[model samples]
Target: MIICELKNNQRTDALVSELVDIWEDSVRATHSFLTHADIETIKLYVPHAIKAVPHLFVARENTGSIHGFLGISGQKIEMLFIATQYRGHGLGKKLIQETMSLYPITDVVVNEQNQQAIGFYEHMGFEVYDRSAIDEHGGTFPILFMRKP
Candidate 1:
């Protein structure tokens, strides 16, 4: 697989749509705590979020099929999603490692109910430093704020 940062002009609508599909698939696979309605509601903002993130990196196969992506803003990882079939194959880790080498990434927020994600972040050397009863969107899902320190 190859990982590369996307240039501004490369973030076309078609790419955003593809990323959104990956995001939704990943969310459905890992975020079982979310109801269908919750997913639908959150999906509305994903495209915009993908477009607005300061740095976007994609992991793709040699054949040029994207399998995962990471989004960073400031010193935080705003998003990371791997296609369901690509999970556990080190693509996510590669993305994080590559981005950390280029950016001073220190923080990431994960859903408390998503134990798999929490464990993954912990394995990646992040520790929970704070917690919130609601998500950023004011949803009921708890949030765990982690930092690499």
Candidate 2:
């Protein structure tokens, strides 16, 4: 598998659709608090965000099929999603490593209810510095603000 940056023209409509599929599948596996309706609503905005994010990267196999992706806005990780089947692999770690090499990333936020994600970020050397009562979408699910220590 190869981890590489995605160029503008490389993000075709079909590729966005494939990335959305991965995003929804990963969210379904990890974000149990979200309803199907919520997923549908979030999916509506995914395409726009994919195009607007300043830095976007993907992990693909030898066949050039993307299995996971990371999106960054400046130094913060705006989004990172790995296909359910690809979670246990080091793809996520590799994505983070690649992003850090390119940007001075020090802050990230994770759904506080998602223990697995919190643990993963903590294991990755980030510490929770603060907490919010609601998520950015104004949802009840709280978020933990973390930064590298």
| Candidate No. with top lDDT | 1
Q: How does candidate 2 fare on TM-score?
A: 0.96
lDDT of 2 at 81: 96
**Which residue segments of model 1 deviate by more than 4 Å?**
none
Worst 10 residues of 1 by lDDT: 1-10
Summed over model 2, clashes come to 0
- Stretches of candidate 2 off by over 4 Å are none
Candidate 2 lDDT by residue in tens digits, 14-99: 99989989999999999998899988988899999987788889999999889999998877999999999999888889999988
Cα miss at 112, model 2 (Å)?
0.8
| lDDT (Cα, tens digit) per residue for candidate 1, span 86-115 | 999888999999999999999999999999
Clashes of each: 0, 0
